[model samples]
Target: MSTTTEARSGFSPRVALQKVGTSLSNMVMPNIPALIAWGIITAFFIEDGFTPVPALGGFEDAAGNPHLGIVDPTIHYLLPLLIANTGGRMIYEARGAVVGVVATMGVIAGSDELVTMLNLTQPSDEQIGQIHMFIGAMIMAPLAAWLMKKLDQLWQERIPAGFEMLVNLFSAGIFSFLMALIGFYGLAPIVNGLMNLLGAGVEGLISLGLLPLVSLLIEPAKVFFLNNAINHGVLTPLGLTEASQNGKSVLFLLEANPGPGFGILLAYSFFGRGAARASAPGAALIQFVGGIHEIYFPYVLMKPALILAAVGGGMTGVFLNVLFDTGLRAPAAPGSIIAIFGNATTDSYLGIALAVIGATVVSFLIAALLLRIGKQEEGDIAAATAKMEEMKGKKSSVAGALTGAGAGAAGAASAADDSGHTGRIEKIVFACDAGMGSSAMGATVLRKKVRAAGFDDVEVTNKAISSLSDEWDVVVTQKELTDRARQRTGSAVQVSVDQFMNSPRYDEVVELVQQRNDPEAAEEGTGSEAAASTAAGAGVGVGTGAGAEPSADEGPGSATAPEILSPESIVLAGSATDSASGIDEAGALLVAAGAVDEGYVEAMHDREATVSTFMGNGLAIPHGTNEAKSSITRSAMSFVRYPEDIDWNGNPTRFVIGIAGVGDEHLELLQKVAMAFSDPAQVERLEQATTTDEIRAILGDEKESDA
Candidate 1:
């Protein structure tokens, strides 16, 4: 709701790097379950971990000691296939995964020993190549997948009608075979060399004392959601190769170190006030223990200076990691204290714990210094409030929410005159640089709005802007990403909304879609048509959208629109006052009747403190926030009319509507409230009425309350 411009307004190489990292991160995310399972198998059953569960076969060693059999094939061959196929799916879709896995076999078997049916132990170790192949698979999977995608495109363009199946099947088989050969002959050697070179580079850095410098790129990238890609695509494979030789590799500790995030959250927990302070404990727990380091992204985003804190923490951790020469048997999946311990070597445990603790402490100190917690949060609130009031209804000046960036693109698109052109939109896709963190959240918000507004069939989804396709009906993205998304989506309706978190324009999208899907709703003043929601204070009604047309005023308990307001009870206004939260006369009545709790009244006040609830002319609807909904036992509605107007968020309120919704039922009820509020005549009539029954007629309510 703040009017400040976002820090992501411009682009730079760092931004692009972060995007690549995010792309790799999101691409590898679906494979996490597999990776975790593989890591656990390696850690527990492969004889490298504390409680070594035997996998292959246990036998006596040369010294008559028990030698636990290790499942070398599972880690060397199967894990690489799973990793490669996963990366493949991200690049070329499902078919890419099949090709990538198939081709990876070449890397696994290319220089390896072969058995002869005619002879025993015919192939010697000298004739065999035993490259771990994680690096090889990583390089070749994307290559094979890209070729498959290109071939699929070619087949689509040129394949003949009945021969399609035969040609497609044959082409895929040939390509898979060729890719395998190519992986063995071309990509595997190159990838193997590159892995060694990178591994050597790490060793060189450690020797030269430059290993800690990795944090310079890492901390900022982690802030941008590159945590997964940097860990899985770049680091994990390298660690596997080193771990194969040394029983563990410090490479595993590099990306999975949860220190920076933990540090940042720790700072917030101590220095932050208000909601930031309240949320920090949970966030810290998740970041450090749950291993979801992304939990602190917003904290850094809020104060960019905190990135330095993260950097300091990351560097400190890396320094300690190198100093101790510590490593893990497998990648710590969650990077949680538990996961790290689970994968830890006996020698590496102290180092890992120390590194994480050191980083956490460093990050906390830096973030606390940067947070400027001593500054009064609301010292400027009074001034800002005055400025806000002067600019009320002129919300377009605000940068990212409904009025700012979201308004420009969506407002233009949803304009009445632009309606004819946008009528074809059937599905909407939100695209972002990284996709999930911003674009996915944006898509979820819009989708909920779409469903709330009664357009269920309109598909809503998110993808990396790199994945935007021309087939999409519409593409939604932040202003900075719109041009890129437009170029990729190609003539698809592209809309730019600022701040993917909260778009004021999603309502516009819902309206446009409603009109497109239910043409009758567009007709103004239709007797049986639902009205599309505009910005806040939009009229709500029941008609062709979800509920039935307003039934003939049946006097209060009628099921005119069950999906609309399920009115539970109504009480006329009683002794209400001003200056506090609301004229609680209405709230007390509802609470007295058990329709809602006293908490509902307090919730209404809390909402009012942030913004006024007064509808224009003479009405106010009060309800707890989404977070406050836990106070309500069920979905219900109640109303209390005031004899005199009480100040409601600046506007006078004679009618107080109390709503408690379970699930999205409140959203359905909101439509009717909007309709009644938007009409000056109805509001005027309600103000003149002295009884709840008269108020019911004004609200298009036909029946008595269920109570």
Candidate 2:
């Protein structure tokens, strides 16, 4: 892995803030249903509701007696507690949740105390309203839980054996009580003041006609996977606070409005070129009707200038909402038209409707004009899907299906030719989140396969997804990050894999590269590279059973540094029952051979605890961590084969190769081993080998023959 690649420098302010926002949203997103239920109840039964119910709405009854209602208590206690409990659980699970609720009660109590104090000091008409502690809960819950976790860790094993239950119970009770007092006296007042200031700021923004400018910040963040963060983290609590006090809030529409995404997709449908134009209509329906605004993020990213359309559309909606004083009684999730209507204030219907319409029109017109001015053609739907995945950093089945991204490795073969080049894949880049660890390992494995396939002209390197460029002929990524890789380049064929150590996809990529090379071979007609036969259907998954015909490339002497592996070190059908015992057996072999100290075996276990050594295709390469490198006496490897699988960190493992590498010395034999096992056929031959001699033959170096 190249460290110079565009790896995120330490602590990016943007990424850090986004992560914090994401964490806040995580606490609320799972509880959206409860918020929706509250919204429905308020819309239907509150004092100004269509059918007011004093009993449920907490209003004066027909007899002029006030009744406590579900509305007041739900917002005052239930919602805050729910938020607290969710926040706590995120920090420390059930124990954290308990402490969080305990602390939140104090905040709620302090809020009531403040309300009572205001009533005593001020005239009834000027008295302060009940301050709900939603913000306080958001703060105190996670804080209380984190403190409890650290406290418990302090005495984790110091407690006497029989007093464990008593110590735990009393400690938690005392800690909760202390935290509750802190919440009531310290955090609650601070949060209350903060909320008041924020509420006033929003009112000021609205009055000054500058509230619409928020769309500039919001619209761009949505494309970067921060939609939930902005919606649930910043807006929801404030919107809920306003709704609790005034029965409706415009804040909900700021991010939830679907008009902007819908308009962008609609514009693409009419003015965009290639697959973006073809797929825009369906994406428009998903965005507008399905309330999945994320579908249109790719369209904006494909042509970054299109974000102006989103900003304009967002501003138009907010401007209309401000002008008409239109607002929803509850947050409109999915930003769907139906949801928006369902949650609108009774008198705000026309205004809300117009806001949506105006937003859509503005966005569409802006996007259409930009498309016309730029005239940039999106390569194809596959490229669009790749771009979508690249930005999202995850494989989206919906994106693939929506953009026809399912073309897989086979479709990548035409990528070179499609771009008006002779079909040749010269540069391959392996990408992961940080472009380290597993990605580098996967690249090494694939690079070995590519070289063995006789495509030595191909360049293989590992890169952080952030550094991916269009210069590469092919880009490979782990399954989780494949979607993110797609957005990096339009010309590269994209490949995804679950197992970096041995993926069938590696063979498929090698085959694609070889196919691209075949055209050049045919043009030459008499080159030895063309004359040399390749194993037929070598890329196909085949078992290399005993007596199976060898691939032309796997001839004897192809192995590099053959002395590193010997028949004496090979063990078949080992007696180990599980991964630990299996590690012990493999490590013992290396110990006896003087390859490593006994401490190295323990280090291997530690390394395994950090990350599983399991490399796909039934192989686990157990090695000591960097800290344990001093235990190595020489660069050597020992192989142990288990006929029956041992579970190696949830992956079924049949082979364990204990390695003690002195810098890059071990990479040579490691590469040869990768080449042998990369072919399922060769792996099958090793599995079926009855004698140690046969095992040695299969495991021997098979680097490309120099002669």
Candidate 3:
């Protein structure tokens, strides 16, 4: 024998029986409560208006009704079977047969409808036979299972690691479709064969005086996974005829698993305790009348071995039921209460009592014995803990940091320099209304920009516009926030941009900063001195230009009088500067031109709300997508924020704001802008510059002269 089979054989009969019993109990325990509730509902349906027939008279009713329709009883048995069977399939195989069951029912019902339609005129016998075959095919279909399995395998093989969740949903859809087909055409014949065999054996068992013993075993056994599969997977799709409505079928009692209920009652009856004693009566009330059985989860979990005992008792009960030729129209999940109203023979109550007694005795004895023997380890606690710890650590790593950021953007950058403030601006505060949306966006944009700009010691934060103070080094704000920022930072530079929020502008902003810091270097390549000399000659030609020119602050050659303005400091901030480009597309162009880091542009796309930075009128400023702190080396500035407002979140915006940072370098850019804006002429000159090249020329010339 194989190792597995040898292990199985090593168990003593009693132990082996106990193991089977536990598996059965585990399968049936959770379903008991829902079954009892459904059973009561079935009873009500029959009692209200449905008619009962004598052909289905075996099952007793609490109301003492002699007749009940097959439909009502069939429903009672069918629903519980469906739930138990489906639950079992889900537990064991992680796949449910419900779709197949439904499809089978639909095909049969549809075929019946077609026959009825034909009968309205007049139907032939052959036609009816054909319809029956069609129904049979529908009920026994197998194609569904094959299709579902194929699709599951395909998804498992092809789906990438990060996208597993999306694949699971796709697999579920395929599985559901296949199961529906199986229910219709793959299950009918098997049910019929079982019924035929049952019919042949019922009489012989009664004649042999084996009815009671069979009843004792059969009823409980049906509660296991195997019988549950047949009941739900087969009998339910057989069509709810009048016989089933009248509670005539033997299938009803097979629906519910009374093993757990019996075990609980016996336990309480024999070992009454403080809470256990009090709960016993309630348990009996629910089990007997309500038919709910989930009251046993705690019991089983506490003493798992008892589960096997319960299963053993259930199996015995089912066997006895079959032997007695007892049957129920409706299936009961927790069989205790609803079985009373199901279809049965004249001695139906005897069958119920026998099932209860047999199952209880077997469960109690086994449970008591197992309890005395002590518990076995079902799982390794230490291994489970270690596994959990490992998972937790993985979750805290870089991969975990990017879950919501989308596959394209996750873990794109480490948090090594993400503090927002590192090199320079330690007391920078960004302000906007509500301090939530716009300010947050502005802070993120600046942080990323500063980080990229190589300043790692800048601290940038956001606050409500009204909360600004003089403690801030550079107060950055939207036009709407300018007034409040001014009040908060007296004497400190209040940099107000026309855009709603600051966005990444690494290239242009960095270029502007470089020029401002070193005018000689900026003028090195560009003929700034020559441009100034030409402008001076033109002024001289205007007659008073020579006289109007301010006298050199120093005598002729004394260090050439600090020019007072830098050429490269000039910039406009709006979308009109690049009419042919989207903000991101333009930002990309700038990045490619040694303007900004590519990471900043990528971050803008990741946030989904990158366009929000262009608040209104002739303006489009894209910001960083990350909420985590970061920075850029410099901010990119454009000439005309924008002449006409671009459609930004449905509002018109004119400014095209771009910020690029190395790391915490935002404060320097802010200070530079503050100094530039301090002179109104420079701002006006930028607005009127017309072309991007002209703007660059004007700013370039101004910086050299100032130096």
TM-score of each: 0.51, 0.60, 0.32
Identify the superior model by TM-score, candidate 1 or candidate 3.
Answer: 1
lDDT of each: 0.61, 0.73, 0.42
Candidate 2 residue 158 Cα shift, in angstroms, is 2.0
Arrange candidates by lDDT, highest first: which order?
A: 2, 1, 3
Clashes of 2: 12
What are the per-residue Cα lDDT tens digits for candidate 1 across 494-589?
666754433566666666665545545554545222233332223233223332223325333545344233334665654565625343765665
RMSD of each: 17.1, 13.3, 23.9
Name the top TM-score candidate. Answer: 2
TM value for model 3: 0.32
Off by over 4 Å in 2: 1-10, 61-66, 379-398, 406-707
True-structure lDDT of candidate 3? 0.42
Total colliding residue pairs, candidate 1: 19
Q: Flag regions of model 3 displaced more than 4 Å.
A: 1-227, 234-246, 254-261, 268-327, 334-358, 361-707
Q: How accurate is candidate 2 locally (lDDT)?
A: 0.73
